[model samples]
Target: MQFRSIAMAIGMTALIGATLLAPVTAAEDVPPAPLPSQSLAPLVEKTAPSVVNIFAQKVIRNRSATRYLDGSAFWRLFRDTLLFGYGQDRFESSLGSGVIVAANGVVVTNYHVIEAASGILVALPGGQVYSARVLVSDQRTDLAVLQIEAGGAALPSIAFGDSDRLKAGDRVIAIGNPFGLGQTVTSGIVSATARTSFGVGDFRFFIQTDAAINPGNSGGALIAMDGTLVGINTAIFSTSGGSQGLGFAIPSNMARVMVDGAVKGQTLVRPWIGLSSRTVVPQIAELLGLSSLHGVLVTDVFKGGPADSAGLQPGDVILAIDEFPVDDPQALRYRIATRAAGSTVQLTLERDGEFHKIAVSLQLPPNEPARNESWMPNLSPLRGARVASLSPAFADEIGADSGISGVVVLEVRIGAGAYRLGLREGDIIRDIDGRPVRTVDDLLTFRTTPFKSSRITLERAGSVLTATRN
Candidate 1:
């Protein structure tokens, strides 16, 4: 009995030990692994559903033949039917990419894509094609929405990621129809953000990436790793018509604004204060008693534009707009574009060593009647005023001061902010709040959305006119 009892105790102890150590053994098997910094697989898989191949065609009166505008016998006879094809010419056939934004077939693409398209065809990921109709386009934002007629057809859509939340070095994936190769995926990191000169549509803030974006990738999806759409692939920094690891996309934040406005045929009227601008330069700064050359310098103010109507003037330095800080021209543009027209905006600016607050309500750009010309200017950047540097001889002829150097106001758009400032052909813009203007690039770099009000100090006919757009 004693021997049997001892054997039973030993067996019970052994069983208890095994039970206690079993949990520990399982825990040791996993051991901890380092967290992953990035992944493109999820981005490609999830975002690809929203990207669609876009093909558009429009019947346009072919303008292949030339006719003199002087209206000669040959010109008048052929102008209507021969030079410009009367009815039979098919003027457009183009390919691009688009992202499905709605489960009911609402799609988003670059404005230029379907601006002139008489017919639009959208191809789904599984190789299904459907007809589309353009809802509306905001030229200022370069954003357009299309409506597909597949009511009962289940469509894959994308969710908008906060582009404002993206940072440099974040991993991103681009899926598009590059060179019309159907659906293609490329990977890269956000190299930079908010570059202005890419000129994709009318938007300014951008997510710059090293992704391999090529032609036909316009309006494609640029997404974060978790499949959130951060941007729309639009333009590339290529010299040879191929990807050079430098591409730009429209941030999804702006895309959302445009897409929302385009829904159900609503118009997107971007807020405008109405003024022409040039960048403040070292010379302009010194001439105007400014310590630093920063912010957009108002070169001209419209006579009745928001700036002119509100007492904002020429030569005022605009430092910030709507509480968003700005130092570059592009920054101002980003701030303005992110707002709706007729919205009230405030600026903080310095004038004569004192800061001022200017409140102004924005206006929509004036409408232009449709022209018969082929919609080829859909992507052109010279959509605004024509400008060049002012000549000393011209200044002297206009009785303007010789030291006031700036580009000439050769043309004032009828409804532009500058034209409303009573800006005519002869005004010599001397300085922008202690800064100087000299070149077109200087003007391009000039930003006004940051300032509370724009001030312009120009010399005209021996009198210095300081106009303020408040």
Candidate 2:
């Protein structure tokens, strides 16, 4: 019996060996299925060439140096010899990234990237470099478009994706020159959408991502899995100026507007919805009888404006814009801003426990008075100040009460008497020397015919203060 058991074991071992040595089938020769991965390799390969490193150079004035002789040739020679003239003018350079969005080498980046740059150099992959010119920039949205002569080279361009379709947990990739390092890519998931309260831009609805965005990542491309541009990586919320897993990107929808405007050689004239609103908190939503706490509470609507003309009530809760959910006022602004002027949009709102859809025609923002500003260099209490006639749009843009109309101080130079006396930019001159002042001319008249160091009552950021030059 023992001999028989040993014979069976030997036979079993031989059978296993024969099975292992047998010719593998074509299916067996095929590699095992790849492990599931969040790899962005394929997407990066398709999009990385479109990302470029931007080096901007600017000359800035240095004010800390002592003047040997004010405005004299002798002082200039002495200063140049002693300080190498570095104190008078200092050269500054900024580093950022941009993405080519057109085959003709049209690039898009953050406005701050080339805000004051006198010269811009774009370095593409494979070491090719080219000079870039600013096509257009919109500071309100912090977006800039650049045009580069590619010397007949067909540049790779990135396509814009639907940022409005993004949701939390969606994978994203950020490609840029982090810390001046040439072209690095980082991956993370979208943490939130329509995020507001950043206090950075005028219309602030940003896409929050956990991608490792650092200093030089500004103006870089945030790409979706389909190899499309979802947003422009802009700012990071970091205490150490490094990646803390909190990054913000301007939505591609907004960036698209700037690019379209750049192509048309015109500024993006966004249609205004003419409404001021606040995000609906859970308590507010509950009190309003909303099925879910996911909407914006309209606080005020401009009279004779689009919302008013559409019969929108002040207490209405804006649920969505053409099926896109509106969770905050910023979201509503973003939706309207992205649409063209004269285009009609449907606003889904909840009013008095009933949901209603209203159609509103987008209109150009109110024609505020031109800031054709005049400087007051020789006038007291107004010296070193730039004043403009404040209109509804200007006041609204500056976060002032739209009903308040007066000559608003645009700037007050440091060390000026006005600055010393608590006068500042955005200070609306309610009255000067107890005289009612409503325009820049009124303030100029008051300053020219000054009677006893001007006494001024100004409204600044909702607070009224009396400033006396005497």
Candidate 3:
């Protein structure tokens, strides 16, 4: 998700360190090292002025405390600053970055940075912080647009580039505040293209670079050599606490779609077919009596969902969605999420050794988040249903109150212990093995410690009940 924690950062840095570029040779090996970047001066001078730093402050309605009773050195520091504020007591605060894209100070940044924000400010290179208003935010792509009243004053701005034409090895520059270092810049070559990390969003297309991006770099500009905004600096792929140089940016093309809609006060729609797919292997290809394994194999179709209503079924190989080829599962998702919600989708599917077309009308995700946030972790589990330990955000979705606790079921295998007991998705198990379960670790401990026939108690709406799986 949004990367954090020193230990997590350190691990990511170590992972990316192994992939860093080789060092330049001294003396005769090379006539002279290539310039730190080929013609970077002109690019920086053109775009740096438009890349602004975003400062947004908001109150998180129900945030969890950073400290537990453990009282470790880490918690003690958190206690001093967060809980007690060392004594004076301060309120909750969140910070991130942004970029200027219009002469009138129209700016863009991650939607998360401004969620529930009461105040937003845009900081120019000269340290002039201008008050800004959120025009709109698209949670699907995690992109938001804010406008600073430029009035008659001239503000620096950058033009968006054709992100579809981007190629690997293209030189890029990132400008933002890394760890609160104001207006810092880092340069690197594009590491990979069309990369997918579902962690960023359910639908995916990222511009990967080796630029040294950090926490405060969110919502910054990923500029190309021609001084165009190619992408929005977003997340990093790291295991260590610091940047080992693997950074990701949201392509300008996708960002443009949301920005255009936001400016018009229109919500983007997404079409859905209600099917889960898996990459087809050679074995599966042969089993399906297919000549190749290029298409996405439909593995599960939710009963009574759009796909089912449209006569789409499991074992159907999806070849295409509209014009874009369904070459990968992520492509299918990307195509749909980018479409207007409630629109009918024309899908090419191969079923019963015959290929044909079907149009399925899209439905809004049933459990869309309060801010229209995307999917939550699946809580269908073997141990009396599951909840995810990933984020505290989903705790309330499963009927969990403030003190509720447990490892959420990310997935539930059919015929498993919990499935056989009539437990379904969105069930929150408050107690396991007769002990109040608060985390995944607690459930795992009970799984091995002479525990059997668990007396599981769960909260489904206002009712609480027990189930047994011997």
Candidate 1 global TM-score = 0.64
Q: For all the candidates, what are their Cα RMSDs to the real structure?
A: 12.9, 6.4, 19.4
Compared with the true structure, model 2 gives a TM-score of: 0.77
Q: lDDT of candidate 1?
A: 0.72
Query: Which is the better candidate, 2 or 3, if ranked by TM-score?
Result: 2
Error of 1 at 467 (Å): 23
Please report, in order, the local distance difference test score of every candidate based on alpha carbons.
Answer: 0.72, 0.84, 0.70
Q: Candidate 3: how large is its RMSD?
A: 19.4
Model 1 per-residue lDDT tens digits across residues 1-470: 99999999999999999998775556668878989755566557766877999999977764434433444455556756675634235567899999998888888888777767888999999888999998876555566788888867879999888887788999888999998777999988999876766755543667899989999999899988767888888788888999999999988978787777777456555545666555677898889887677777776665556777877777888888866666655566567666677788898877886778898887764322111111112121212344555543333233233223465555555655665655666565556656775645555555565546667676665456886656
Residue-level lDDT tens digits of model 2 in 1-470? 99999999999999999999998789867889889985678889999999999999998976544444554777667778976774587789999999999999999999999999999999998699999999987787888999997787889999999999999999999999999978999999999998887877777789999999999999999999999999999999989978999999999999898888788888656677777677888888778777888888886676778888999877899999999988876677788779888899998989998989999998777756565577876745568888887665776566554444578888889988667888788888878767877677776676544355667888865457888776
lDDT winner, 1 or 3: 1
Q: Give the range of the ten consecutive residues with the poorest summed lDDT in model 1.
A: 369-378
Ranking of models by TM-score: 2, 1, 3
What TM-score fits each model? 0.64, 0.77, 0.60
